[model samples]
Target chain A: MIPYSKEVLQHFNKPHNYGKMKNPDGVGEVGNIVCGDLMRLYIKVAKDKKGQEIIKDIKFETYGCLAAIASSSMLTDLVKGKTISEALDFDRKEIVEKLGGLPPVKIHCSVLAGDALIEAIHDYFNKNNKLIPEKLKLRHQQLQKEKQAIEERYKKDKAV
Target chain B: MKKVYLDYAATTPLDSEIKKAMLPYMDKEFGNASSLHSFGRMAKEAIEKARQQVAVFLNCRPDEIIFCGSATEADNLAILGAVKIAQKKGLKPHIITTAIEHSAVLEPFGQLEKEGVEVSYLSVGPEGIVRVGDIEKVLKPNTVLVSVMYANNEIGTIQPIAEIGTLLKKQSQKIIFHTDAVQAANYLGCDVQKLQVDLLTLSGHKIYGPKGAGVLFIRKGIAIEPMIYGGHQENGYRSGTENVAGVVGLGEAVGQIQKTKNEIQNIKRLRDELISNILQNISKTSLNGSREQRLPNNANISFAGAEGESILMALDQEGIAVSTGSACASGSLEPSHVLMALGLSPEKAHGSVRFTLGKYTTEQEIAYVLKVLPKVIERLRGISPVK
Candidate 1:
């Protein structure tokens, strides 16, 4: 049995933002075919009366396992109060850690959640004509390269 | 939160009696059957005794039984062995099997396909039993083996093995019939003569014995070649050091099942009651396979639209263990191929929960499950996107 932490189970049992927003500021979608786990992140980024850019609302729609649901719920909870920059800085490991560490098998699902959130934040910046931080962009590129390498390795193995 | 194990089809807990039967072999009586000494004689006698017990359970001669590592290896020996014999006779071999056979049978047939061996995967109807007519229709001049399973592992559907074997014997083609009786050996009445099959496979673990022990029953006159090459063992059929403890455990387990045959109906009734209670309490839920001709202990159901993993998780949290017809507890979330073959969509397949009853399952435990499962399904459904 997969050991989902109490916090993860609680959030998975009753997720925070479980539906679509009216018109989300930035929407990020991640498709995981290996496990058939799909997640969609809907972010509502706006300012209060003080004209400071703040996330007004964040919602998630996930069709996945407990780890996927909990990670999405935790992703929303972790990024709600943070600035766009801080939200972008949210790492996959931090999200996994926040859930008291998901099992090794399900770590990829948590990573998917983190990747989706960062993409959502980046989408928010892109739409607002704000430049994505150089570090996040570089990390994103690195992740893409790593994913490609893994896929290539799998293809080679399959060929053999 | 009471723990109840129903997935006995996947694997059964080792019975204490079988463990007791195996202990002496594992400790003081550990000796090679081929060795020339008192230790060897004791071990050899024990092995012969085990062979006799297994033969009695299957209603076959003691000489006909060959111990293998697992039923999978037994199946490989039977199918591949038959094909190689036919190939040597300058005949291009053809085989027939049901679409719903376990990977053990199907995967080997797949490998044989690469070697130009023609295979016909006969399809089962909505009832999930491969029709004898389908097998009749697919018979060829070179058909060497017709391999069918005694019972399906996923949906618990029992194939009409006796009828098929009887009909095949009348054909002039002389097709050597084989049935992978791994799932059906202990639970069902498996007499070799009544089934009229030349070969059959049985696994120990499925019937409350230690894992890694199985038997292959080859009728006295059947000719075959050994796939594994090594020192002569099991009359030069299966090669390797024998699993002495595992063999003793298997024999003991089979004996226990034989002694307890009267309790089969009671377990079936419990399974039926659990199915009836769940169906009566839950909404939009339906049984997956045939009702009348299924395993006595299986009740597979699909709760519409709700994710199976979430329900399984919720049930696990409540300490009631069950299995899904969808993804296994393994990391990947692929729905079960068995359900898909029955024409269920991936979504419907993902929603199927297989509640298999066992010897230790009680009415009160099932009642607890009947109470907790509906609430869990409702809760998961309430959170479901499709719902």
Candidate 2:
């Protein structure tokens, strides 16, 4: 049996922000049924009276286990009142800790939720004509490079 | 919320009486059954008594029963053993089996096929029942064995073993009929003579017994070469230190179920009602396997447009334990091939859930499941993109 924390189980049993947003400013969809998990995050980024682009609302739909649902639910709470930049800076460890930590096998769901949030913010900027932020782009590229290195190492090990 | 365990097809909880029956073997009387001392005599007597109990359940002579580590090992011994005997007699080995056999049987056959042995895979129709005529059609000049399962573990479809056994009896003297009866032994009476099966396999764990013990029933005079080479044990057919506690547990478990078959029937009645209510109350849900031609306590349902894992997780939250299919392959991303063989699309196959009832399953648990399940299915389907 999977020992999900009470907080995770609670959100899994009763998820918050669990539907598609209407005419959202940004939308991110990741994973699929074939992948054993999927998440769609929608955010409405509005210009606050101070002219800062802040997330006015957030919602998510995830098809996975308790950790996936809870991670997505917790994503909503973290991003709802934050500026687009703050939401983009949100880390998965904070989400996992808030839920009192998920099982190791289910940690992938948290990473997926975190990636979806950043993707949504990127979508927000792409729609607005602002240049893609250089630091986030470099960070994404760095992750790709590390992933490639890991794949190369795996291939070499397999060959050996 | 109350917890309901409905994955008996995967395994059953160890019966307490069986545990009690096995206590002495695990502790004080742990002497080797093969020794010549007084302790050995006591252990050997217990082994013989357990063998008698298994034979009583199988309705066969005790001499025909051979203990093995598991049904998989038994199946390998039966199939490969038959092939090896035929090969020694200068015969080309040919075997027939169904498409939906457990990997324990299929994987061994698959390896044999790679070694140039011919294997004819008889396909089942959408109802998941293998036609006896297909077996007859595939029977050949060199056919040495016909291996089919007595019951399917995934969708709970019981095969027409009596008919198959009768057909195999008339096919050829050389063609031995073997059926993996692991899932059927708990609910179905496995009288070897009545079924006309030359060999049968039973797993202890499937019938509330220990995990590491099983029986392979080879009718007297059927030639089977031993797979493992070692000192004589199991009459030279299998070799290993005997799993005495496990065998004892199996014998006691079988005896307990045999005496309580009537009470089990009552549980089956509640099982049938639970399936009926789920089908009646839930829309877009259909039974996966044969309704009438299945284990009395098995229910496999496919809820269209809802992922099986999600429904299973939801049910888990409510403490209603169920399964997507064989626990062996649940972690894989692939849908159950057994469901796909029964003519379900991959989507429908992925949406399938199996609920297998056991002796301990209760009507109140079913009521709790019925109360919680439809809501979970509806909520998941509401979020599903397919609908």
All candidates: TM-score: 0.86, 0.85
TM-score of chain B of each: 0.96, 0.96
Candidate 1: what lDDT? 0.82
Candidate 1 falls in which docking quality class? acceptable
Which residue ranges in model 2 land beyond 4 Å of their true spot? A5-7, A34-38, A49-52, A78-160, B84-92, B113-118, B326-329
Q: TM-score of model 1 relative to the true fold?
A: 0.86
Task: Judge candidate 1 at residue A16 and give its lDDT.
Answer: 89
Q: Write one digit per residue (lDDT tens) for candidate 2, span B1-387.
A: 667898998888988888888999998999898999988888888889988988898889998999999989999999999989999999888899988899999998999999999999987898899999998898888899999999999888989999988887775466899999999887888999999998899998988888998899999989999999887888989887788888888888777767767877787798789888988999988898788898887889988766776788788877888888422125554567688678676557777888989888877888888888989988876665456
TM-score of chain A of each: 0.79, 0.83
Model 2 chain A poorest 10 in a row by lDDT? A151-160
Alpha-carbon runs more than 4 Å astray in model 1: A2-10, A19-42, A48-52, A82-94, A100-108, A111-160, B328-333
User: Per-residue error at A61 for model 2, in Å?
Assistant: 2.0
CAPRI verdict on model 2? Answer: incorrect
lDDT of 1 by residue, B79-116 (tens): 99999999999999999987788989999999999888
What lDDT score goes with residue B178 in model 2? 94
